[model samples]
Target: MSCWKYWPEIEEIAETLEGLGAENIDHIDELNKIDIEEVKKQLDRIEVIAHDKDIDFDSAKHILDNERMNKALKLIRKFYLYIGARLETENAQEIIDSDLDPDEILNKFHFYERYEGLLENESKLAKFNENKTFVFIGSGPLPLTLIMFRKKFGCKCIGIEIQPEVAELSRKIIDKLGLSDGIEIIVGDETTIEDLDYDILMVAAFAEPKERVFANVWERVTPKTPVLVRTYSGMRAILYAPLTDKQLRGFHKEIMLLPIGNTNNTSVLLRKIE
Candidate 1:
């Protein structure tokens, strides 16, 4: 959806609210001018309102007019949320302190996954394996990919999730399907932890933190390791981590736009160089 691309704008609006403070409603009309359409947009608004609860009121308003500073602040907040969600999903506990309900946020994330045309069938898991190791980042509905990758590829997997319920559900599904032997899921914090090596790192769209994580992994891995990333749509690798032919590892780099149903997932495969 176009909303995915315009998430930055929504985040900017949230920064405005962050600057406005909870009690500062003098300009509430100006803020109310923005239309409330989907859950994603509403969540952005809620995130800003939630910020007023903890942030100093005066400091929040002081930075209101500073567009650049606000933008940066939103990114930082976004990253924090990503880290918290990953922890919550992996550990099955909520880590972030926020006025916004974790259930509400998770629901919106699920809505995004449903709308993005992610996974639908079991056969897609044909490539998964229980022997080899793999990691799935940003479990925004693409954990289905992990399920399939594990089944089809016969590889062991660790799913790095941002929502506890989602992660739990994925784990349950794996168990129900009798595929638990190969999957080990964890929550990743962006600000901490060194990169963990894996045969592949499967990423999904709308995962800003995971995108950065991939770049971090690339910087650390030896030339022989391979990283296969998955994107929902758009010029994936080009927009995020573009690897040059010279920079590519000896393994291989592939750009694939696979059709799931009515939608398509554009994924880039970057193998490590040995």
Candidate 2:
């Protein structure tokens, strides 16, 4: 019996890998056909198969490492972001309605504390100082990064949100927290950075078309300015696409920070080559 007959889930993932490698068509269409929850289930199965000594680990590893599988995984991550953006919109309201302190809510998410420590360590290595201006791309509805940066470092921060509803809600949250003076939430995209001045640039984890954003930043921002990119590697690859080796070639300085908690997500500090 063939693997497809015995292991349908594995075959489904294999088929997705083949499909991604065969075309350069609309990724959204391909993404629409996939169920994020289902994909996670398939990935979980693959992980188990890869570790099972009785199973063919080498064969499973080959399929997992296939170039096409990586591409398909990236598309799945895009789908995840698409779904997450909508969820975040609802979550923002939930946070607002809960009557909990915004700081307490942010701390519950662990990002505020994670970034606080990450930035502190980065400051020592990169000679970073407080009070610098920060512009966050794809700041989403919560703008946790902006709030954290301003609260922790006393930095001036601006958040660019492409979705009008998310931008409005994020502003409301910022205002409620009385951070309106320190953090500005603008309704815009990556292009918004072109007209603004900032000492540091932060790329959100869900930001798409990252290559284009990087190119735009290189063309518009000063070479001395540092860009902090939140990306996934290792097991987190299921949720986010990690920056590839080729992507790191453009930056003059690149430092990969330590992972936070159990999440496979990490930050990369980059500076444009002069």
Candidate 3:
């Protein structure tokens, strides 16, 4: 089951969050005061809710909709990811300084197993091993998805991160992982779409202003190049951005893969007929 922390205390959390708080959670000082174990516990609790036989999807969704619990849930996830990125950067730098193998640290990452599960589901729908070039937006400091794609399929992976410092850190960790040759990280935002040439484009769930990013890619990406948007819905929409049918109305082909609770985002693939 999916367990999100503080699922029961959503009202208090929501009150703590200011306006449009999810977008600015990374810089929230009060959130930083939250103990790491507390964050982990909350996430664990959230995951378990998804698997509770007594709670159907609709019931869980209703809970989130009550008192705008969804906002608090999303704030927790954004905070979780931001803290995770910072922790990864610190630990990775230590490993690099020691000149030790980066494998152990990478393999033990918080979302390592979750990412593996996501890729398994993705490969079932997309051509990951057929020399496909993947461009992942909002790779953050770890760029774990791009790294996994390169190592698992031996395919070329390009990560476009909006934060320059995060992109620089991603490059450092990737180089330590000995994947610098296979993965490339560039610093730019949604407008970077015009500069990339890839067979597959994947947008990260955490990428902000999701609508504008989708629109930018739609306008500039090559027709028929499959654009896979990572989204969430139902109760899981609390953990990530939700995608609507309205956002994907004009695609010639549309496919959505539901997560089995081990992961967060639902992969939505859209292709233009050209």
Give Cα-based local distance difference scores for all models.
0.46, 0.64, 0.71
Worst 10 residues of 2 by lDDT: 1-10
Of the candidates numbered 1 and 3, which has the greater TM-score value? Answer: 3
**lDDT tens per residue, model 3, 1-274:** 3334436555454444433344456565655555556556555655555435455566666666666565566565675566566666666666566655688877877777888878877876678864778888888877888988898898899999888887888888888888888899999987896877788888887787766776777787766687777777666665554766566555544777877557776777778544
lDDT of 2 by residue, 25-103 (tens): 2464554455545544554554443334343424443434667566555555544455455445545676677787865
What candidate 2 gets wrong by more than 4 Å, as runs, is: 1-64, 67-79, 98-100, 110-130
Q: What is the C-alpha RMSD of each candidate to the true structure, in Å?
A: 12.3, 6.6, 4.1
For candidate 2, give the lDDT of residue 65: 62
Weakest 10 consecutive residues, lDDT, candidate 3? 13-22
Candidate with top TM-score is 3
RMSD of 1: 12.3
Put down candidate 1 lDDT per residue, 1-274, tens digits, no spaces.
1223334644565464455342332343443343323323544454444333233424443344356544544543443344333433432222133345533443344333432444432223223345456766666422555655565557777777666766666665455545677776566532222455565555555456544565565666555544555442221111223233443334365344443433323445565544
Candidate 1, after superposition: displacement of residue 94 in Å? 20
Q: Give the TM-score of each candidate.
A: 0.43, 0.70, 0.82
